[model samples]
Target: MKKVNFRNKDMAWDISALILYPPGFNEASQYPTIVSVHPFGSCKEQTSSATYGKALAEAGFVVIAYDASFQGESGGEPRYIEDPSQRVEDISRVIDYAVTLPYVDADRIAGIGICGGGGYIFSAALTEKRLKAVVGITPVNLGRLFREGFSQYNPVAALEAMAAQRTIEARGGEMQVNELLPATPQVATENGLTERDVFEATDYYKTPRGQQPGGATRMLFSHAQKTLSWDAFAYAETLMTQPVMAVVGQKIGAFGGYRDGHEIYGRSIASKDRQLVELEEWSHYDLYDKAQPVSAAMEQIVPFFNKHLS
Candidate 1:
């Protein structure tokens, strides 16, 4: 794998990415390519690269795993903003860069997004016609995640708070940041989140299991409004027309991934083809990096891309 950079011209920022080539790569030969997107508040190196980047490259496809705008090694102001609209646009920008390469077979392109990345890829497929196939891995719909929460909440309250924070920031006050999950396992227990998936998330994002410099588990408080209101699976039956597959784990507790994955698959009746693969033993975070769960996911994932992008 080698480093590459491209512009998100719409957002006026740059995306930092790792492009992995199949063995004995040659510029003269065109190959099917995939854009691997990382989860919310995560970087390319954590799951996208650490798990799937090299695997897909070895499977004989050119793969580009990228850091989202305003996070990881990518460039943007007021960093750590996990905006769904921008994130969805980022995939297309990467596709723009991918097609320009001499070795890429633009017509055979597909995408797989992890967690929030999964939602973004789904949203991208709703309109991005160039994508022949798309997959959602442990998909989290930010709108559903925020609005519904563990039980439910008055989203107006959260939106009001976000507006207040933006006002403060406009006055040159300190920017507020919020953690995506309990900071640690102990913290999770103290907060009464003793689920297997929640604990696994704390382990992966907060500890050495998945921690990295740019993969911060924080997002801007001011930007929460957009995420709270945007539904990742909105208009699935009408808008999404690409071949789709949702690689989901058994939902353990109130986790958003399982719910969103099934939601998208069930709703996308208009897709060219739609499939959902559920690994009963795995939880949401288990699919993030665990060997057994990851392998199971790839079994469904690899062939879908292979068939559609062939």
Candidate 2:
């Protein structure tokens, strides 16, 4: 694995990334490349990102796991801002860097994103023709996640409150920041979230199990406006023509499920080659780290990239 830094021309931020090579990799020969995108408010070092990078690399592809601009080790001001548009642009920016490497096969570039990053990968693949193939693992379209609640429960009032906050921020009010997970297990238990998705997320992200110095738990509250309005599959009917695969867990909790993956596959009208794989008894967070579920997801992912990228 090698660390790399490059300029994100679109956002004017320096992106940090790690490139993992296949075992006994030979720089003299060109190899298919895959970009692994991290989850929301997460960094390149997170379990999903590292897992994809290592697994794909061992499968004989040059894999890159990158920190999105403005988060993790990347260079940007007002840190932890979650701009969907910029996140999509970050994938293309990383591709731009990948093409410059002599050992990389520019024509065979592909991408895989986890959680919210999965949504960004789909959004980027829509217009970024350079990405030959794309895979989404337990994807979440933040727009839908914010506008329609996780279980499609009532969330209109919450969205309206976000709009109101947007107005406040526009008036120079201090930017409100919010935590995506409880800072402590006790807090999660106190909030009656003992076995919920957020509870698991809190344990994974805030504890030693998946913690990383660069993996922040907070994000700018104003980002809710952009997330509520953005649709990850806005152009799937026509613009998203690339071969795609979406892998989702069958037993994902109340906060998320196979809805986004199903929606993405169903709406990919222009894609002649698209598939959805649901791992049995796997929760959304399980796909992030658990060995069995992650491996199950990779079984679909590796072949999808190999078939398309070849």
Candidate 3:
């Protein structure tokens, strides 16, 4: 593993990343590459690295896992804001950087994203023709989640409140933020977050299972404006012509990745090679770092990319 950095398109900030090369990698020859994306509120050091990034590299691909702007080791101000548009663009930027490498096979580059990164990777592949093959490991469509409340959320009402807060902040008021996960599982139980997804979220994100600095479960409240309106899979059926795969755990609810995985596979009508895989016993977060689930996921991912990325 090697740490690297590159300026985004605008050169406004540097995106921090960890690049892993397959064994016997050579600079003299090109290799198929993957831009492995971390989940929402996650960084390169987390699952993107611990699991998929490493796993894919071991499977004979050059994988780069990066931190989104304003999150993790990446540069930007008002940190931890989950900007949907920015996240989508970050993948493109990573690809832009990838193409510059002498050892990267420009036409064979692909992307695989976990959790929200899964959704963002799909969004990226919609327009990024350079991404020959794509994978979404339990994706969460951010805009859809915000617009259609995961848990009795009122989109209009929430939008109204977020608009009000943005106005206040623009007028010199204090910045407000939203917490993605409760501080602890016990706290979650006290607050009545009893759903399977919520419990697993608290366990995976709040505890050592997947926690990392800068990948904290928080974001600027005002980011809701764009998040609520953005649609990760909009026009996917018409525009997403790339080979696509949606790997989801059957034990998903509230988290919504299962629904999203099924939706993308069904809706991307133009993707003649699209696939949907449902692992029966694994929950949403189980695929993030668990041995059994991650290993199971790799079985499908390695062969798919191997066949498609040629």
Candidate 4:
């Protein structure tokens, strides 16, 4: 495990990155690489995607995980804004950086996106021909979530209000964006979501288990509205030509959201390589850490990448 920094696209934006490489890495040898994408508004540390990165690294691949632009240690002003297009571009930029490394096998690079990141990875994979195999873990399609609501999860009006606020921000940058998670005991029910949805989200942002001083949060109103318009699944039919693997937790309600979407992608596309794996007794957040099924998922991830990327 080594801490590293790489230059990103926007001026003054530098991405803080971590590289987990197998023992005996040397200029003489090139290894396969996996770039782990973190969830929306999350840094590399909070999501525990690093756990997957590290495990894959130890298993003989170079695992690179970094804070998304404008979040965590990554540089960007007016932080916590969510631009789906920019986030997807961040994945591409990270790949741009990864390919320059001498120890990395440029053709063998793969991606593992968790939570909202899962959707972003898919979005990028749709257009990024360089990415070989892609994995989506408990993906949250913000467009669908904001438009249709989840499992009778109603925040339609509240989300609309948020969108209106975003429009206001875009016209004139006056209002500071609201931090979605409240300080102390972090409330997730602000959007009229059920207690379970709120509590589950709070478990990650509030607890010492997943908390970071400046981790994931609500996007600025302008960015929020833009994300509402962006739909990654829309490109599923075109993107499914590449291998896509989706891992979900069967125990959680929101888990079904992406499962059905991925299935639709598989059905619509002509590719035979895409697959879906549901981990028994695991919930959405369980994949965020070193829980039982998460470790199992990690084990499966290496082989999947190996089979596809090699």
> TM-score of each candidate?
0.95, 0.92, 0.96, 0.86
Give the best candidate by lDDT.
3
Error of 3 at 10 (Å): 2.5
Q: What is the C-alpha lDDT of each candidate?
A: 0.87, 0.85, 0.89, 0.73
For residues 209-257, write the lDDT of model 2, one tens digit per residue.
8899999977877555577678999979898899988999887665554
CA lDDT, candidate 2, residue 27: 93
Over the stretch 1-310, how does candidate 4's per-residue lDDT look in tens digits?
A: 7888888455368888888888788867888888888887677876634567767777888888888877878888777777788788888888999989898899898888888888888788878877888888887776666555531355555567776776777788576566655554433455554454446666777778788765756566544556656787775776556788888877666434345435535643744477777788777777778568778887677778889877
Judging by TM-score, tell me the better candidate of 2 and 3: 3
lDDT of prediction 1: 0.87
What are the per-residue Cα lDDT tens digits for candidate 3 across 1-310?
8899999567599999999999998889999999999888778898898889999999999999999999988998887788999999999999989999999999899999998999999999999999999999999898888777632478888888888998998999999977878898999999998788888888988888777886777888875578888899999989999999999999967879999999999999999599898998998988888899889889999999999987
Scored by Cα lDDT, where does model 4 land? 0.73
Q: Which whole-number lDDT from 0 to 100 does residue 201 have in model 3?
A: 84
Give per-residue lDDT, candidate 3, residue 235.
93
Question: Ten consecutive residues with minimal summed lDDT in candidate 1?
Answer: 145-154
- Clashing pairs for model 2 are none
Find the 10 residues in a row with the least total lDDT in model 4: 146-155
Candidate that would win on TM-score: 3
TM-score of 3: 0.96
Write down the lDDT that model 2 would get: 0.85
Cα RMSD of all models vs. native, in order, equals 1.6, 2.2, 1.4, 3.3
**Backbone collision tally, model 3:** 0
